[model samples]
Target: MHYIYLHGFASSPRSTKARDLSDRFAALDISLSIPDLNQNDFSHLTLSRQIQQVEALFPPAPAPVTLIGSSFGGLTAAWLGERHLQVDRLVLLAPAFGFLAHWLPRLGDQVEQWQTDGYLPVYHYSEAKELPLHYAFVADAAQYQEESIARSLPTLVLHGRHDDVIPLQASLDFARTRPWIKLVELDSDHALTDVSTEIWQAIQSFCAL
Candidate 1:
């Protein structure tokens, strides 16, 4: 089985959660591939582009793949699983369902300005500086629907009950009708950084790693 990890938006392969999981997987003598989703160009990031990039990293079929993603990356993984049968399982950490809806509204009137300017200055946690991301990012993300991700598989979603970024209701709604998905509500916030051990334990039990 091949294990691949995708980091959250504006985050990198070296994120706190990514490194924590990587170290845990290493202790088990397992190799985890965490790709840098930014690809050195945060200026032109799009959800479709992210899906394509991660798709290229997947090993050939029959190898059995497990995807572990955080936040926006988690949303990307869900779409990937829907499109590729090669994805055997998914571990979503606060997956950004209803991402555009939650984020766009926060921009308020600036949304129009971003469209006119063609870019928005968003703070990238990994880079430690605000980056000018093209408006295409929002446009591309709007094309994907959380409801359309209907692929049935062994999926585990760990969401924070107090999540303000992507409200817990988003995951609750997504998993409500999907019997294949197991939703575990954690006592943490959006980052879930404080409860890394709980997250890892759930992953081990669910994935049997």
Candidate 2:
């Protein structure tokens, strides 16, 4: 069995959540693979490419793999679970569904400026730099706009009520639509701050699946 943790947008696998989870999973004798979704070019990141990269990481076998995705990575994991049959379970932390919609609005008038300028400056949490996101990123996400996870796998969603970025409602709507997906509301923000133990335990229990 493979244990993988997918990080969020602008965030890397070396994040506190990813490292702590990796350590906990290590103690359980489970190998966790947390790949950098940005790859080589943070300036031109796309979800589709990350999806393919993650798919390629797994060998051509029928081994069950559990996915632990955070924010943007959660969205990527959901896409993977929808396509691949080997994903046994999912543990999402504030997934960014309808991300384009949220992002465009957040940018407001800058959307036009970004489209005209061809790039938008955004902070990269992992790199600790204000990286420029190409306009192509938004266009790429549109390809999967109508796509959603219809699979009924054992899923656990941890969201924050104070999360203004992704909004807790998104997770609620997802869990509401799919009975198999369980949503947990935390008091923290979109970061799911100070909930490492809870997240680890949830992942471990879900790994038992």
Candidate 3:
């Protein structure tokens, strides 16, 4: 089975969770793909392009592909699964569900500036900065219809109970609407730094199934 690991917005394959998964999968002789999606202009890049890149890394339709997406990546995975792209399973970590509602307004003038300047400024909420501007464009382009999408695919959703970024209740609502969805709540925050073991366990269980 092939596993695709997608990082969160403004994050890369070199992120802590991505590197950890890569190392663990390598030791088990399991193949995984984690691509860098932040190496371009945020306003110009679309979610379709990222999906195409992921498709190129894997095989064509009818082949089994498991997607593990974090934050914005999780939202993208949910969208892909809804499109019926032959996904075997989906694992979402602290997915940004109503991102367009949250980010687009906050980005305000930056969005218009992106249309004019051809790139959006990377907004830094905390100490960590320096991510690609195209990430915002991708986020802007994402549309969440989890209720319709989760019906067709087996989904494992991991969200922190204290997730300040994306509310945990939103994930619960999503799980409540879908029959094939499972929810695992942890005590950590949005980053899920302390729940790696549980996350790995969930992945192993889903992959085995």
Strongest candidate by TM-score: 1
Candidate 1: worst-modelled 10 consecutive residues by lDDT? 142-151
- The RMSD of every model to the true structure, in order and in angstroms, is 0.6, 1.4, 3.2
TM-score of 1: 0.99
The alpha-carbon deviation from the true structure for residue 203 of candidate 3, after best TM-score superposition, in angstroms, is 1.2
lDDT of 1 by residue, 1-209 (tens): 99999999999998999999999999999999998999999999999999999999988776789999999999999999999999999999999999989999999999999999999999999989999999999999988877777889999999999999999999999999999999999999999999998999999999898
Candidate 2: list runs displaced more than 4 Å: none
Query: lDDT scores for all predictions?
Result: 0.94, 0.85, 0.76
Clashing pairs in 3: 41-134, 42-133, 42-134
Model 1: residues with Cα > 4 Å off, grouped in runs: none
lDDT minimum window of 10 residues, candidate 3: 123-132
lDDT for model 3, on a 0 to 1 scale? 0.76
lDDT of 2 by residue, 78-141 (tens): 9889889999888889999888877788778999999899999999988888999899988888
Q: Write the per-residue lDDT of candidate 3 for residues 98-208, one digit (tens) a residue.
A: 766666777777777666665566743322664345444645465434555644688999999998778898788778868788889988898997889889988888888
